[model samples]
Target: MARLNLWRWGVFGLAGLYFLVPLAASVVFTVDVPGQGLTVDAYTQIVGTGGFGSSLLLSLELALATIAVVLLLMVPAMVALRLGAPKLRPVVEVVCSLPLVVPPIAFVAGIVTVLKWGPEHLSRTPLFQTFVAIQNPDFPVVLVLAYVVMALPFVYRALDAGLRAIDVPTLVEAARSCGASWPQALVQAVLPNLRGALLNASFLTLALVLGEFTVAQLLGFRPFAVWIVNVSGSQAQLSVAVSVMSLLVTWLLLLVLAGFGGRSRTTSRG
Candidate 1:
């Protein structure tokens, strides 16, 4: 058993090293050279290039938009499943989880085709028009929508787990006994308990949105990932610097979300 544990730790350490080595090399290469031991020129050059800033801003916007949209869509549906029709929870879960089962390329391609080929009147509706306006494959909207879809599973699972964790019957009965309406109980009791799970889902969704590349690339949306690829192709040093900056930004966002999630979890337990 001790030998097995040692082997597992050894494998985990090697895996960590494998991932860290390239990142360390990239940072070193950006900072070190023959004559100059260290320099911030690479970073300055990346910032000086106007495209990097625009792309970074666009990526951040898309991530925020995706988070907002996902929460709006997922939270209500989850609440309904948890408090309204318990029998339909499984069906709802399957439906939301379908995105994970389907190949991203295939699913996105189908969505594109439906948007292009569906009825003219339907396509011309205000909602459809707005969706197209925000999500033109030629712009950053595709990235935003793709992020929402990809992050759905995380949000759904977190919410479902949260809903399951609460003492639903007891809360409902207590509220009823106290002359509180069903809606009031749900708003006051259920929502409070679910806060931790909701925050966790939001964090997971944010991380996924920040790192995604394929949908953005296929849809021709210029985001941080695409910018990284472009910069790498042209200037190696600038590419490394941008990559490092991107990592820092992503890490900071993740840290903020993690802190919220941790606090919420502690509150839920209390």
Candidate 2:
């Protein structure tokens, strides 16, 4: 027992060092200057920076939109498949997982080609306005679409695991027997049982959108991640501070999500 305890402590210490070391270095680098021992100037400067507010708000909006779109698209489809056609789940799963195999650059390239071709082909028609509206800089529908595709794999897996854990057919039947419509059955019966899965999916999608850079940058939208990169060129310390702040935000979000999810699981199990 003594040896086992010692081994556990040793493993934990190593794991802590692995994560904490880099965070410590980042803290030092952000605040430490040649002559200044310690200063909050780097952190303080973040607020004054232009584009910080707009970029962060834009990313937050995109994240919310992505979560909404993913949930609306996935939840009903998953429930329908589970209850109506189990065999089709595999086919749907493969489609959702395609995002994992496709490189972001390639995916974005296809999107660019489609967007470019749309106007050229659909020019002089009302359809061109539809294409133009999607690429609007203030609220880029293109980014939301790309984010939904990128997030599909994670969202599907989360929801799939939750569905597997619950007996969907039984629950839906019970709800229907009680005079509920299919939509109401899903809302009142199925979704309550999927609280944890919903939180997990939303958290992953939010984090992915928050940290995603490649797609947004390549497509010419200056989101939170792209803004960080752009600021890095001009204000190195402030950029590092922003990175640390973003990391803290991610951690805070995860903790809150886990808290709610864990409580839901515990209550349900009880």
Q: Candidate 2's residue-wise lDDT over 229-250, tens digit each?
A: 9999988899999999889977
Every model's TM-score: 0.80, 0.94
- Pairs that clash in candidate 1: none
Give the per-residue lDDT of model 1 (tens digit) for 1-270: 999999999999999999999999988999896698789889878878868877887778788888899988887777776667889988888888988999889877876676565545466666677656756634556567677888887898988888788877688778878888978877776677777787788778877876777777766677888878877887888887888888889889888887876787688687
Best TM-score goes to which candidate? 2
TM-score of 1: 0.80
Q: Each prediction's Cα RMSD?
A: 3.6, 2.2
Give RMSD (Å) of candidate 2 vs. truth.
2.2
lDDT of 1: 0.79
Worst 10 residues of 1 by lDDT: 134-143
What is the total number of backbone clashes in candidate 2?
0
